[model samples]
Target chain A: MAAHMTNAHRRFLQVLMSNRITEGSEARKLHQHCCETDKVYYAHDKLDDFISTINSHLQPLFMQIRKGISEDDGRAHYAVVNLAETEVTKMASDYTEMELELFRKTMDLIILSENGFASSTDILNLADQLKTKKMKKKEAEQVLKVFVEDKWLSEKNGEYTLHTRCIIEMEQYILSYYQDLAKKCNLCHSLAIQSQVCESCGIGMHLPCARKYFRGQTEPRCPKCNEFWSCDTPGVNRMGSQT
Target chain B: GKEKANELHSEMSAFDSTAFAEDLLTFMGINRTEVEETNDSEDVPADFLPSHAWQKMGEEALKYFRRAPTFHYMMGSFKSESPVRKQRIE
Candidate 1:
């Protein structure tokens, strides 16, 4: 199907199919290329045609992003198509024991506290919390080191938050025990039923809805949750399942 | 309460937050340069927050999260989201 698309149209589709939600500067790029008949918006007309065609093909996967969450810090957010969420339901054993422990620590912190990101200080302090076979502050730091290196969690601007990969991959584990999923998507009105669920607060929008929300803006967020809609569509992630 | 504090403090020497990030940088093969670190200062005017210092260090260590680990994922379809004890198609 991509064979027929002009180079401009293909480029737009490549960015659109990205696992990451269309938001922030990425949102601007999409709109710039899809709208504005001027040469600045590369495949303007062709992108329109492509979205219309591919939107329905991937609808079951919530490929269209029509909504967004805006945060208090002043940033736009868009939920992307979490293509891996439904494939596996648990943290697969592919991780080493130490890796698993770090993942658990993040989960504990997030679930125990109503807040989303786990401050690095609090996590390192876990060494203090441990009474037995304790991780030296060095060991504790090592644990976090492994986590950051592995993409289980992400650190940005001095805060550590569970990556969307971990959140969506571990949604069952994260939400099943704690956190209520009461918020609903304004665009689709669906229960934010899938990976479109918010990381900070439980809210979401279909991928297409999120993309559309970013149709022209630099950063469009989920108005209800106020989170910078983000996803890492860098490569394939087989994800976890029950042991 | 006293016991908890002791347990946590006992770990002070074990978890040097700064050292941890520096070491992690090496482990991840990030090009790292040594910076002079000083820990000895003596002048008794009391406005020190030890926890804050540690907290700040913890935040500093988090910048490397973007270079997270990569995994080689395999592709295969699972039969179900739950385990079933039924007959096999094999």
Candidate 2:
């Protein structure tokens, strides 16, 4: 209990409670809005400090405001993470045991895949094999949509992968669960799921990181092995029009 | 007739409106505490609105929200359960 915990902090936390996760820019706007509404001191650069104040109060409650990056866009994000793992089903309480089982299996597919994504056809194939309770393909399809709407998974072109919110919230769990199999981005040094691997050394860098690092270079080289970067640098062609 | 009229007058005196109003307000859980609080403030006029009740309610609600697990932790917990139990078919 910091003496400075004010209504502004409470209001900001209340909004975050409903949202669960927020991108950096939206969070900054929220910070300003909360302070203005509560008539508290506001500083654009002090958002992190303000969050820390709220986090301190939440520490005893086994919660934290964690910062992570968007794997696809390389932008910052903040999410509320729960550190406690009691016997109770604390996450997604609204989901049934069968749905959770499907989710876990889906995670297996995505994390183990070389591309960090699992096609819907493959995930839907898991619907019948769920050991908790076999689900009809139709029911499983609806559940997948709910998971996407809840921000746990993102889908594109029939491919499904962990959403940015999931990465930010689950980075530690994934890192520990997969251990050596989970490679960190060579440039940013955070866990990189959707990343291009170095052919020579086997280190990984996020596509965005690779794009930024290799920008304006005549030839892209691996940051780790200094070998020729084999993978197509994502968004390389669009760089010309913007620059 | 005089004795009946006297009994009616006594019954009417017993049922004071001010006292009855106070009792009704107290049973509804209003007025008492706020009246006492506002009594000390001569400049500010007293009204019936509850003070700090919403702030207290918000704090109580937030207590539950703060304890909720993030999605990863929930999934991890589910994963740690007995594989034998989870393998049961419907």
Candidate 3:
């Protein structure tokens, strides 16, 4: 039988529902706060177990509290997922048909690109081409801003990539949909959107994972083929440098 | 024992459904008195009874709450193009 849900679990679920996603450190803090406030047993190392208890209750409702590591930084994150809905209907309630079309096109650009990013200009150009309803450049820009604010996408230097939460939730869907096109990181074995592709073998590894693997080596070599790893070693302080 | 059962029934009756319904209407930002007055004045259908209307509102609220998207669900929603988004223009 699953662990019984307590006031602490309910409190945590409430906060998570409102925030949608929380980073590892923040989740831990929230875990501690919930336990203390509810006068439940609190343990620093028991956050995962605490979440599992909540997940058991949510299973009947077709929801789950999922944990995943960020491809950009390798930091852990928690997001609530809906297991019942699929594809368009999942988001149709919040976004219009045109907006959904734009977002899908944006995903195509990012996922199919070598660097797993779509430039702002490229994404903006698709707005007018949307099949459902053409969106003006200004309208598309506003929608893009909303996407970022809602944490569906993250932007850097005017380039857009899927948010960590998106990757966590859609990993299986993306893998199945993209088939050979979407590559998984050989190291972590998870979907790698922002990754370095091996020139000879075509295997991919997330930048953070590659950094960790090649940290002390004199010359980085492909773990699979043992060939020279050609990509520039991402700097320690550059992206998700924290161990 | 018979007196105790009667006392329980009286206590239960003291909890007024109309008062509770008015409180719910106020919380939901609906003016129950205005609705009641309109129903009283107009040839409103039986379906427009205050209790029925509030019950409908409650069902709608439940639907909205249940459909509220989680962060993961919200992001996963944009994969409409599926295998690939077609090239719109050459």
Which residue ranges in model 2 land beyond 4 Å of their true spot? Answer: A1-3, A88-92, A237-243, B1-90
The parts of candidate 1 lying over 4 Å away from their true place are A1-10, A16-22, A34-55, A59-74, A79-97, A114-117, A125-159, A162-243, B1-90
Fnat of candidates, each listed: 0.00, 0.07, 0.21
Which one wins by lDDT: 2 or 3?
Answer: 3
Please report, as a residue range, the 10-residue window in candidate 2 chain A with the lowest summed lDDT.
A234-243
> What's the alpha carbon RMSD for model 2?
14.2
Question: A1-243 in candidate 3: lDDT tens per residue?
Answer: 489999999889887876867899999999999999999999999998999999988998778888988887889998887766554446546787788888878888898899999999999999989888899999999999988987879999999999997787778767777666787899988888999989999899998899899877766889999998888766633333354
Across A139-182, the per-residue lDDT of candidate 1 in tens digits comes to: 77777776666545677765676654344334433344343532
Relative to the true structure, candidate 3 reaches a TM of: 0.72
- State which docking tier applies to candidate 2: incorrect
Best candidate according to DockQ: 3
